[model samples]
Target chain A: EAGVTQFPSHSVIEKGQTVTLRCDPISGHDNLYWYRRVMGKEIKFLLHFVKESKQDESGMPNNRFLAERTGGTYSTLKVQPAELEDSGVYFCASSQVGAPDTQYFGPGTRLTVL
Target chain B: SQQGEEDPQALSIQEGENATMNCSYKTSINNLQWYRQNSGRGLVHLILIRSNEREKHSGRLRVTLDTSKKSSSLLITASRAADTASYFCAAPALSNTGKLIFGQGTTLQVKP
Candidate 1:
């Protein structure tokens, strides 16, 4: 089976512009999650989705950051009016229902906001 | 805030040498996990040790968790150049919400 995949391996956007990152989880997986890693910083959790429902979003940085998983098979994270601090590698992970911790990660989307 | 902190921010060892890195966390955790990230790549899950378990091994990798001290260590035996990468330890928040807080990470370099 194919591993998790992300779109636009790298993105460069203006500070005030809006950017949307996409993630397609592995087939037959029910749990999907988002995480970010700023330069010289640890990877931080952003949010998590259980199928079509968001299980946890307390880690989301702010209102400007919106994540959606309409059909549950895929997810989209949009950062509106991006700021310089938003520049970082955004990672997507997935896991089966039985084992929630053995998450498989996707090659992150490196977002650079100028 | 980051949940764990890895010691010896960086390490360099010759191939065939054993490489060990330690991680210390503050809160109670349901389980602790180790992950490896190659440059420009995603984080790959290495091993997971439940709070009650003290030691676990997979192939050449050995992981030990000491809940009493709230610390864990990862040891890669007979390391190879391919073992060079950044290692991170992560744990779910105190709430156990399926989200993980990662450590600062230890960058390991195994020179051939």
Candidate 2:
């Protein structure tokens, strides 16, 4: 019964570079979600992935951001040409679709765009 | 977009006192949840109250929802230094959507 886990706990990249953050959710969890909290801001939802398909991406900021959940197991969020504002703590969460509100979160990756 | 917004951005109280925080939202919700976050860390789920329910409790945590006013409140009874953390309220933006919008959060500092 492991909890959500995220990779690259901290990332420092150039403004024009690309970065990919990964999240391994709890085993048997069908709902995976991405969220972030920028400087002086609240945690905000980025997208939701139910299994291998994206359930909702309305929270996605712009085109430069892309998210995918492969094989309905793990998820990856990639940001190309990252901007200064993209620097924030990126969090990944997972839950059992049967109980959607009982989501468990990961440690989060601290992304710093230089 | 953010759904619930917490009041009193920060709070401080003695260890044995009770700390109450309020959250107000803009629309209807399927379920409202509370979470606690340590500094520079992930958030831990605290409690969840469904739209049809008015109040729920777990351990020392108490949660109440007022759908009529589109607001919710979280009360931590007999707080402790271990309770020092930021608290947030979240609600699903749309039913069956599997998405949640979180509040600004209330920072609680329980003094021993």
Candidate 3:
């Protein structure tokens, strides 16, 4: 089975620009999660989705960040008016509903906001 | 606030030697998981030890969990250059939720 996959392995944009990162989870997996790691900081959870509905979003940093999972297939995270501090690696992970603890991660998208 | 914290921010060892990394968490958890990440790469799940289990092994990897102490350790025996990576320990933020709280990670470099 294919593991989680993300798009645009790297992205460069200016501050105040909008960027969207996409993630396609493994086939038949119902759980999808988003995490971000800023330089010199630990990886932090952003949000989680079970099917098309969000399971938890308490980790979302602010109102400018938005995440959606449509049709319970793929997920997209949008950062509007990106700031310099938003530059970091964004990782997408997936796991089976029955086994949510062992997540498989994607290659991650490196976003640089200048 | 991160739930887990790994000790020894970095380590260097020669191949064929043993590498041990420790992690401690603040809250209760059903299980603890270890993951490895090569530079600029995503994380790869290594092992998971439940609260009730004291030890588990997979090939050259050995994981021990002490629920009473809220600590865990990962041991890689006869390490190879390929084992060089950043190791992270994660636990669920809540026993019923899948949200994972991660540690700062320990960078291990194994010389051939």
Cα RMSDs, all models: 1.4, 1.5, 1.2
Q: Return whichever of 1 and 2 wins on TM-score.
A: 1
Model 1 lDDT tens row, A24-92 = 999988999999999878899999999999999988999999999998899999999899999999999
Q: lDDT tens digits, residues B1-112, model 2?
A: 5688999899999999999999999987888999998887898989889999999999999999999999999999999999999999998877566678889899999999
Better of 2 and 3 by TM-score: 3
lDDT of 3 at B86: 91
DockQ of each: 0.80, 0.79, 0.83
Off by over 4 Å in 3: none
Models ranked on lDDT: 1, 3, 2
True contacts kept of 1: 0.80
TM-scores for chain B, in order?
Answer: 0.98, 0.96, 0.97
Say which prediction, candidate 2 or candidate 3, comes out ahead on lDDT: 3
Candidate 3: which pairs clash? none
lDDT of each: 0.93, 0.92, 0.93
Candidate 1 reaches a DockQ of 0.80
Candidate 2 per-residue lDDT over residues A47-79, each given as its tens digit: 999999988888899999999988999999999
Quote each prediction's TM-score. Answer: 0.94, 0.93, 0.96
